[model samples]
Every structure is written in C-alpha cells, then in structure tokens.
Target chain A: METLERLLLGHPFFTDLDPAIGRILVGCARNLRFAPGEFLFRENEPANEFFLVREGNVALELHVPGRPPLVIGTLGAGEIVGASWLVPPYRWNFDARAVAATRAFGIDAACLRDKCEADHHLGYEMMKRLLPVMVGRMQAARQQLLDVYGHPGT
Target chain B: MNASVAPDPMLPQPWRVQAVRRETADVVSLDLVPLAGAPMPFKPGQFNMLYAFGIGEVPVSLSGDPADASRFVHTVRAVGAVSGAIAAATPGTVLGLRGPFGSAWPVAAAAGHDILIIAGGLGLAPLRPAIYHVLANSERFGRIAVLYGSRGPAELLFHDELARWRGRLDMEVEITVDHADPSWHGRVGVVPGLIDKVAFDPKNTVALVCGPEVMIRFTVAGLRAAGVADDHVHVSMERNMKCAVGLCGHCQFGPDFVCKDGAVLAYDRIAARLAAREI
Candidate 1:
C-alpha cells in the first residue's frame, strides 16, 4: 500500500498533489490484473472507469470491417488509460486489450467525478493535467493512422 | 502617432559566412563569423532569420554549440528561393541577420530528467542545438535519446554528428527514413514508429520534438502513448511568418503566437489547437 502510494504520487496525474490528496486518490483506486489476450475494455462501451497502468502492456485497438484490429498505440506502467471518461459521451473511442499480462489501478469514473464536483480544486487539477494527455493520445492515434500502416497498399 | 521600431538586441549581430560544409546532398551547414568583434549569443532551439541581399528572409535554426556563443552555425536545406540563396552563398559573403529569437529548449529544467528528442526531416535542424547543449552538460541529464527521420538516406542531416551521438554511451540515437533505397540498411519507417523501441521512464522524462506540422502532431502522440506527459513534451512549430514578432498574425496557432509565444511550446500548451485541422 505504501509502495502504491509512492507510485501514485510519482505519476504526473497526481505528482503536483499534496500527500493527503494523493493518499485520498490512492484510497479510491482499486488494483486489478489482466492476462495477455484479455480485454480491458471494448470500443463504444460506456466508460465508467479509468485505469492507471502499474505493470505490463495494453494496446489501444481500432477495428475496421474487413481489416485486422490495428494496434494504434500501446501504453505501459505509469500511464493513464480510458481518458474519454473525462469528457461527455463517456464512451470509449477504441478497444483496449492486454498485450501482455498487466496490472493497473482502476478509478471509478463516477466516484472521481463526484469527488471532483464536490472539490473544484481536484477537478481543476485533474482536468488541467489530464487534458494534455488526452490530446497527445488523440494526436498520436491520428498520426499512426496517417503513417505507412494507415496508408493503403504500403 | 507611430511607435518607433527599435532594433531588437536579440537579433543576430552582422556576420560574414566563413565556410560551408555540404553535410548531405540537400543539407548544407554554414559557419558564420561576426562582422564586428564578437559572435552572436544564442541558446539552443532558438532560430535566426537570414536575409539575402535582394531576396527575402527565412527562419533557420542555429546548429552550433551554445557554449561557444561567438561563432554561429546554421544547417539549411534548399526548399525556397531565400533558403536556396542563403545555401548558395559563397564563403566571405555578407548576409543580413535578425534574431536568435524564441525561447530555448529548457535544458536547466530538463536537468536530471531523461531527455528524448524526436525530429523529422528539416525538423532535426532546430533540435540539433538542444542535443549539443545536453551533450556538453552530459552529467546533468540521465539517458538522452534522439530519434530522427528523413525522406531517405541522402536527406539525413548532420551525418557526422549523428555518428558521434550514436557512439556515446550516455546517449541513444535512432534514425529512420520514410523511404529507403538499396544503400539504406537502417530502420525504415515514420519517426513516430520508432518510439516503442526506446526505453525511458515517462515519469522522469521530458521530450522535445520539432518537425513538419504533421510529424510534430504525430510525435506528440507517440510520446504520450509511451507514457510521457503532455506538459513534459515540448515542440517547435513551423508556420509562415512575415515578421518574427507577434504583430504579424501569420504564425498564429490558436490564441498563441508561434513566433513570440513560441516556436517551442509544451505539447499540452498547444494540444487543443493541434487536434484541429486548421485554426
């Protein structure tokens, strides 16, 4: 628990936080593990939760008809997964699959949202911090799609 | 009433072209000597707008060492009339110079953090200074990694410098090309594709990216996908500018001015604008 607390504090999403707030964030998190080839979440699913990777790898898979599940990008330990929960629609844009056996700390989206609403500072910090991460991820996905693999007949 | 336009002290001091090195078929490096007594002072990642006699001016990054502020080095590719003229200038020719403008790469802040640089084509030119700054202050940083991509082997800039960077134990350099001929034996792919091959603790890493708008957009994504924070990712932008100052709206990216606000900005700072096709 102490080690997890340290890891949480170390993450950019929580780095600027006070230890008390960091502890509160850690307390709200639930640890989970997924084996390789397991589904963490599917595309278009209601995004009720977000995960911070602790170990192993996960691939953000985009499925197109008559095409393979293209690996748009991968995320590893210390990174946040499922950022769509921050904005409206609260639905995933891509499927997330475990590329290797993985461990992550899951935060209930509803609960976090409730806490954020109750404490605007927490809300401000989280959004202020996570917004860029979301944009960066979206831009990266777009880039991958525009890369050689994204181009037809490459 | 008209406000007087004061000469910007940050502008490059008048300099004479000392020599030119054909780094590759397309890229040429110019060594400039100050016309006066001393060389211009410029930080890494800042650029100088070079003016050819009758031609126009173009922003070119300073590729030389920041530690030695006297002699300035510029690496250029012939992409436009002004660029071609500047590249074609013979040794000892005089060229009008303005600016070592824009904020530099945050080498001081980057101290103790693992540094990752991703550059594409001419984008590598701006980032070359940051690479030199880090290498000169080698002990101040953790592992340093640079990933550069170009159209092909013939277009790769700083071949000798790339070789030297590859040889350093403290540094990691990766080169990729969009297309490769028979002579090309290295990795062949977009620069973003190479992000996964390097290992850096995103929690302790800061990434600097400069390249084409498309490449910069993708590289930021790659860094984030690799777990790097948006705030930790810094990017240098390329936009058309008639004036390097903010008064000219040509280089606008959203509410921010790429010329004054930044040619270099944190990924998070411009993330929203970057997501849009046009702004």
Candidate 2:
C-alpha cells in the first residue's frame, strides 16, 4: 500500500515542492477512488478538496436543464483537477465524473488554505504551480471559443 | 509514394467521378477514374487542381490511398464557389484535373523513427494518404501515433477509417473535439492537449501536422516542448494556389511558393514566415 507521504512525494505536481511543503500536503491528502460513471464532485457544490489523478480519467461536465451534461474537458493520469479550491467562495464550476475506475489523491482544501494563511513561503510556492494550470485551462477555453475548425467569422 | 511530374502541368485531364461519399454536412470525398490515360501517380501530400468546367479551379489534396491505382480521391469542404461546385458533383460527373503537385510527407526519411501525425478538422484529408502509406509499412517505423481534433463530433472526417485505425495494436489513434454533447464519451479538448498524452521518443520522432494555421502554430509549440527539433517537424500550408505549377504568385509565402516548394515543408524552414502576420 502506498502511503500518503510516498504518493505525494512521487507525484509530478510535487516535483520541486519544498520538503516541508510536501510534508504539509501529505497531511491534507488522502487516497480517493471512484467507480466508472461515479460523480466525484458537482457544480455549485462547496469545493472542499482537489484531486491529483494517479490513474484513469475524469470528465469535467456542464449540466443543462433539458439535456444531458455536456463534457467540456477531461483530465487523465498525472493531471490535476479542480482549481476552484484556491479561490474565494471555493465553489465548483462544473461536475467531475470518473470516466473509468479512477484512483487519486484528494487534498483537503480548507486544511491547506489554513496552512497557507500561516506561511507565506508555502503560499507563494503553491501559487507558482497553481497559476500555470489555471492559465493553461483558460487559454484552452479561449481557443475553443475561436472554433478554428468551423466556418470563418462564425 | 511516387512523385513524377506530369508532362503538361497546366492541361486538365478529364476524370470521371465514380462515387461521391459525403463525410460531413458540407464535406464530400469524390472518387474519380481517368477518362483517358492511366491514373496519375502521386505522393501522399501532393494535390490536384480540380476544375468544375464552367465554375473554376481549386487546389485540393489527394485523399486516397497512394497504392490504389484504380482512381484518384479528393476530399473537399464546400467553403467557396469552386469547392462548393466540386463537392456538389454527382457520380458520372466528369471534372478536369491538373498535375499532382507539391512536396510529400517524409515517410521515407522518417523510417526507423517514431511517427507522429497531428491533424485538425478537414486537415485530416491531406494527411490521409501519408497515414495509409505509414500503416502499410508499419515495420519500417518504430511507433506510430495519430492525434486528431475537430470543432465537434459532427466535424470529424474519416469516421469509419478512424475506428479501424484505433483497433490496431501497433498504432495509437487519439481523437478529441472542441465541444461535445452528453452522447460523446471520448475526449473534449484542443488537439495540442493530446501531445503529452501519447508515448513517443521526441529525439527520434518525426511529426507531420496539418490544420488551420492557428492550430498548426500551437501543435508546433507542443512538439517543440516535447523535445522534437524544428527540422523534424513538417507542416502543410494551405494557400490560394492559382497556378499549380507556381507561375502565379498567389501561393507565395515569403520567397517559397506553396505549390512548388511545399504544401509540406520543415518547420525550421518557415518558422519566421509563419509568425509574420503580413506574410
């Protein structure tokens, strides 16, 4: 069985994280798994945790009143899901469902937020890594809006 | 794939349409057989100037199997007047065609290395022939992966063929759409996002990319980030090709004529021109 410390240590997301910070993350992290088609989180729910996917895939979906949920994006093994935990209000913007049987590390958002509030060094380090992921997602969303494959001026 | 130039590059040979298969709402693939002499030999990335008799001529990529000598195939999206006429043609409709012009995908040069094919939207049409060649000679390459993306589920080209390729254990095929309804169980993201999802030795890999210019730009960046050299990356440039032989300057990008020097060229050769908006 992989211990929380070992798992957090091995993840790419913690590659350059300070040793103390890794230990702090391990304290807030716990193993999480979801069966195929199981919902990990829903839109408008309090974002209490974020996931570092260790295996399988997760689909981020948007629900419509009269239609089935539209899948906006997916996160696979080695990718992280849910940045909403970092912002104020901390509310999920989309529903995340496991596309396959998935294993991940769920890190408690409130626990980490409290620690960051106490330590500026940890907060800065986390911000450096988290900002890129948020920026990348934003850029991808912008590109999707361009509809490069569709007819021009659409 | 062979690349012998035609004797009269400007003269249009009549090719009778054997069948027309609609791939999408506005996209159609025309299967054509020669009305006179033997089928014109062409390479994977070469194109034909299809004339709609009374309409006009448009440069369309050859989208059929390079080994299939019975007929020529061109997948066209009804984007303009010339293409709309070409796409609307029925079986037995005879269309005029010029030489199999432009450079070809570097399948020969890429032997012994992993092959990465990235396509966006109808860009798959031009890369289809090269895909046929590579898969046919799979033993020559180390690993083969094809990453394709479209605006949505309905915009993807070569549906049946994509499934067939995905079934092969020797190759990897990953398809994504920019958007999808609930019915879609596959990926939903830009094509470049899939680059990191696949396995390839960047140092010993050759990448062939075809798509809208913006998509190509992003795909190139992803390849470079994965350690693939600029020279090892090739992109097909679509331009306003008036004279398929390069006499007209309509297809000129910087100093190279797309019809003559490319449709396919190494990324290093045109990195500056691709970044320039005026060019």
Candidate 3:
C-alpha cells in the first residue's frame, strides 16, 4: 500500500533509500505492538531486530548501580529503535521499554542482512540511510551523560 | 493533496532597522521599520537576519510583540563580530532585514494550556516576545512560568524585566546562575535542575526554550522526563548564518534549513538532527 511505502520512506533509518529498495524494505517489515511498560529488548540482549515506531512512545533506559534507571531518551512515531543490529557488537546497549501502548514495524535484521548480501544495491541504500541515525543517537547519548547528575569527585 | 503549496509572500513582509538600543552591557534591542512601508507580520518565536554595514548578518529573534506589526524588535547578545557591531551601533543605523522567519511558537495551539518558558543565557531574547504575547493575552492561557539560567548575574539579560515578571501575580519566574557570585542570592545550577523545583502540569502546558545548544539538549530531556510531549516542546536553534533567506547552506540542520524551516522548531521535529553533531 502507498501508506506503507510512505511510512518506510518517512523514517530516518529508511528515508533516503532508492524507491526500489524502499519497496523491498516495506516487504520485509512486519508490524508489532507492545503494551505499556513492556520491554522491547534488554541490555546485552541479541539485537537481531530493528524497529521503526509507527505509533506511541518508547523510552531508552540505562541502568547503573546506586543510580536509578535513567531514561536517557524517548522515541516516538517515525523514529527507529535497536539500530545496533546494523553494526558490530550486535547487542542492545540499553533497555527499551514501551512508555505507552506502542505499535511499531519490526524488520528482521538478519532478513535484511541476507537481502543486502543478495542485492548490494539494497545494502548500499540501507547503509546510507542508517549511518545518520546511528551518528545522531550517539551524539544524543553523549549529551545525556553530560546532563545526568554524577559525583563531581569522579 | 496539494501539500506543497507556495508560501504566502504577503505574510512575512520584510523590514529594515531604523534604530538600535543598547539594552545592557552585552545586549542590544533593535527597533525595525519596514522598508516597503508594509506591516511585518511575525509570530512571537520567529527570528530575522540583521545585516551590518561591513560585517555580515546573523539571525536574531523578534523580541517585540507580534500583534503590533508596524515595527519589529530584536534583542541580540554581543557574542561575535556582527552582533558586537549591532550592539554598539548608534540610532538611525540601517541594516538589511529578510524575515519574520521560521516556524513560530504554537501560541494559538497553546491556548487554554499553561505556558512554560525556559531560557538560558541570552536564550531569553527569543523567548521574550512569546512571554509578552502570552502575558498580554493572559486569559487565553493558564498559569505562566519562566525559568532562566545565565553564566552569572552580570551576564543576565533583562534583569529589571525579570524582576517585574517575578512580581506579577499571573506568572512565576525563577532565576539561576551556572556559577554565581557572593552577591548572587538566587538559585545556582543548570536549568534542568530547576525543573524539579517548579510546579506545572506538563499535560496542560507547552514549553518554549532557547539557549546554548548544550542547554537546549539538556532542557528538552529534562522536560521530557517531567512528562512533556515532544511536540509540545518548542525550541529556537542558533547556528552560523550567511543568508537568512535559506539560499546559503550555512544554517542547514539535516533536511531543514534553520533560517527558513526554523530557528524555532517543535522539539520532536529537530530532536534527532539537534542530537547529531556537525549536522
């Protein structure tokens, strides 16, 4: 459907793809829903799935001992989550929890990876689209750490 | 659907600076009159570029009321060359002006909602016009709160106005300093830390923020944690600008031009790009 194509093309992780590749991406994606407070994934878990939120809120939480679980950031509709699957150390770095009842489109990373290997054009399109999202998230994490309260002595 | 309609050229009529006021040690407020004798219609949060004589121009927010469009007003900090010149310029100086630019604070949309304004350092300049708009149309909104943080008392802009704002019965104003002097008898810490001390219903409130890049990032996070929605958090972004008309790539932030698309954007619209460095 055109709506699915529009949704895929609107996402930052897939927005810049070649139309053919975007159509291929839409074919591989499956919509999934999570209840509020549901864990989409846990830290150090196998990051085999990447998601693009279609609706509702999700929180990216990082836990440190003595310090409470800090909500470093929140992702909503039109945002990508679990991007670690694209790069090495294919493991989630933080826990993603559904802040509200959320509906997201889950793309099997291995499926996409397999498709990429089969079609280098799709691979290049996906990579080009994903690079900016990865860089942007890392910058946001760094900014969060700077804001979090910590010991001045440390 | 005709989604890409041409912009209404009549809305953002341009103006030129007729005079400049040195508001404080480092801040200057300009009084602008339209070059074409047309009224310059700008929403409160919009900004414009002021081109100096020899030096280039920079984007400065319209600190004046949007309802009164016969003249435009801008308060600028002397951060660099162009701003320093504008701050020192005498009255009757003219500068090239090209807006009432960018997405505006959703004042009409924010009606019936409490308004929270957080400004750090010179960030107050952009948010000032919004504060005036809200206060002037007080019945349209609920409680008003302002949280401001600066480098120190010496660097705080609008000290007298802030004092007056604090005294108003309809609004609550809190002032903080990143580093304070012995004489600075006010809150001391980052603006985010002050969020816990203030009281407002995030659901019924819309927040408008402008400040240093670092401060904005932190403030948005703080607001989110306090239960504000991304769409409801508006921010005014600052970047180096050569042309305020969006032709130059100097003010590009991801897919949007900070000049034309925004100096003010919904926090959600810019959150990802703002998080990225060198974008």
Candidate 4:
C-alpha cells in the first residue's frame, strides 16, 4: 500500500472513514522529517499543522525561566502530535521539539478546516474522530496531574 | 490450613531477608524466608504487616508467586520512615511479619473467563501474584491481558518480566507512562488508555485493577464503558493500616474493612462509596 493510503486508512482515528473522506485527507497530507533537537514549532507560533506520528518521539515542553525546561509529554508512534490546530487562535501553546529524529504525516490544518466547511460530512467525521483524541489526552493529563500512584506514604 | 500459620496474629513473627533487589530509585523487592518457623501461606491480594525491626510496620502486599512456598516476596516503595528502613535493609536483615490478611482477587472465579489486568505504579506488585496464577493455568482462561502504567517510563517496575510476558502469544501486554523521555516509543498515556487497545470478551471477562483510589475509580469506569459488568470488575484498594486485623479500624471504608473484607473488592460492592468525595 502507498504511504498515503496506509496512513489515512490505518490510523485508529480514521478507521472506517469514508474512502472519499480519506482521499480528501490524503490530498492535504505531506510527509515530514525532523532531526534531533529540531523545533517542530515554538510556543505561541502559528499552529497550521498536526502530525500523525509515524516514527520517533516529539517532546512537548514547558520552559520555565531560570530553571531547566520540563517535558510535559512525549508523542510517539501511532500517536497524534498536535490538537491546537483544531482550535483557534490557531496558535501553538507549547514548544514541540524532536527528541529523536522523527518521521510524520503533517496534515494541513487550514486546508482541513476549509475542506470541513465545504463538506459537512467530512467536517462531522473529522470532529467525531479528533475530539475523542483530545478528550482522551486531556483525561490522561488530568490523571497524571493527580499522580494516583498508590496511597502516598502508605 | 488456618487463616495464617502465626500462633498469634498480634505478635510479629521473624523472617530473614534472603535477597533484596532494587527495582527503581526508591523501590526494592525483598525475598524473605522464615528463619525457623513454618512457612505462612498467603493468597493473591493479601498483605503482610512488615515491621522494620526498630522503625515500625506498614501493610505491604505479597508480590511473590503464590505457588512458591519456600519464600515470600514484597516490593516496597520507600515512602515513609518504616518503608524506607525496610527498603534499605540488607540480605541478612530480620523483620517482623504479621498475618497475610485480606480478601483475595477472584482468580478461581475468573477461570474460564477472559482476564483483564490493569495496574499502575506499585499497583503491579499487588497484582503480580494473580498474573502468575493465571499464566500458570493459562489453559483455564479464555484470554488474558495485562495493562500497566506508571508516572514515567523510568518508573516502570518489572521491565524484564513485562518483556517476557509479551513474548507469549496467549497473553496480551500493553504499557503506557504518564511522563516519558524521548527514548520511549511506546504508548504515552494512562493505564486505562491501553484498555481499549486490547481485546477481551466482556460477556465472559473478569477485570482486576490495582492502583491508587483515584486510578481504580477511573479504571472501573473505563471497564464499564468497555461493556464489562460492574459485578465482573474487581479493584484492590489502599488505606493506612495499623493492624492487619479489622480491630484497629484504620483500614475502614464505610462499613467494610480494607484489611478484613477486602483490599480486593467487587466494583458493585463499593461503587457508591467510591463515587463520594468523602467516605
């Protein structure tokens, strides 16, 4: 299978998507590569794309002045990298840098938004798929914030 | 044959640490054998009150294989003074062992049904015995899967065993970490996230979860969402324990005693209490 077809067809987020919709997605997707320590995006930068991680890790980092930067999360294979593109002000909220050399399918967000507007079926399908990933990641972040690792000190 | 081989439940029996292996920065697994006394029997999910000769005692779960009668095993995370003492003890260190009291995981009842095991951090220690039991009798179960998560990729316990278990075709093993370094290429999320990644027949499945109270509550909710019945889900709960017996009341959860009625409880039995902010 072609890389485009495989990525669009195999992503859990796109499983069972209408082939037309998949085709529309493939039309806007482009392959990407990043070397270690390369910045995919910086804090407050334009969030024009979201990556379907194909290989390697991307560190979502929080930089605190006068202190070492902290990695909030790591995005890896079979995971979706950016959700900020789906929301406005259409700006990145954190620094995403390649922790290792990475390969991904970068989907054009503005293009996807335009496509969604032109086709309600595609828009609804995209919403149903990506919203779950957003919700799931938020829940995981909340659980991590709680550090529910056993009764502390027990 | 009795509840425990200890002549008296209040008095502690002496056990010598045969070996201690550091599992992580703060956690250590101790291999213990009775010095001169008879070996005490324990069931999966049961806990022993281990006293650091001079510091104090705390209830730690039995993490060893249930069928291995020659020694007892416990993985301790050094959180408090007593636990720190126990974790730092040498091979010849002598510690006090009380009753292995508590209700057990439904390993027997879960036979012939698919087994879904979910654990977080040290939660894996308590459920390790049940995993061993299920794998040893794999023919009796329809399917078995283990999902584990931790604070970070570095905090994961039993890394080697997880790899070995994943090598088997019969048992499905998945792991995730809340925070991970760049080197980690596996799932980066909570344990519950991996639940949907594995396959199990909810109609004929038994779910066992062991983690913090918050994690257990979320895990049970996830299992329910995945078509598992409330009655079919079980969780190992934690509370401060002063006495292994129910008398001290430190391990009380509403009317149920965590030390006596459970550390392992059916989801239906405690769902309401678990839902309330204060219990």
DockQ of candidate 1 compared with the true complex: 0.03
The true-versus-predicted C-alpha distance at residue B242 of model 3, in Å, is 2.9
Highest TM-score: give the candidate number. 2
DockQ of 2: 0.80
**lDDT string, candidate 2, A1-154, tens digits:** 2477887878777776777788777888899999999988999999999899999889999999888888899888888999889898999999999998999999999999998899889988988888877887888888888889988645
lDDT of 2: 0.91
- Model 1 steric clash total: 2
Which of candidates 2 and 4 is the stronger one according to DockQ? 2
Predictions ranked by lDDT, top down? 2, 4, 1, 3
Candidate 2 per-residue lDDT, tens place, B1-279, comes to: 337766788888888999999999999999998898788688999999999999999999999999998899999999888899999999999999987999999989999999999999999999999999999999999999999999989999999999999999999999999998767778899988999888999999999999999999999988998899999999999888989777989999999999999999999999999999899
Give the Cα error of residue B40 in candidate 3, in Å.
1.3
lDDT of 1 by residue, A1-154 (tens): 8887887787656666878767767766777899988888999998989898888877777787885665555677677888888788999988888878899888889888888898887788788878877776565445544642221134
**Chain A (alone) TM-scores for all candidate structures:** 0.84, 0.94, 0.81, 0.90
Q: What is the C-alpha lDDT of each candidate?
A: 0.78, 0.91, 0.75, 0.86
- Between candidates 3 and 4, the one scoring higher on TM-score is 4
- Residues forming the 10-long window of minimal summed lDDT in candidate 3 chain A: A144-153
Query: Would you list the rank order by DockQ, best first?
Result: 2, 4, 1, 3
Best by DockQ: 2
Q: In model 2, how large is the Cα lDDT of residue B189?
A: 93
Number of the candidate with higher TM-score, 2 or 3: 2
Candidate 3, residue B45: how far the Cα is off, in Å: 1.5
Query: Which of the two candidates, 3 or 4, achieves a greater lDDT against the reference?
Result: 4
Summarize candidate 1's per-residue lDDT along B22-117 as a digit string, tens digits.
977656899887687666567778877788878878888888887875688899877678988999988998987777777778877999999998
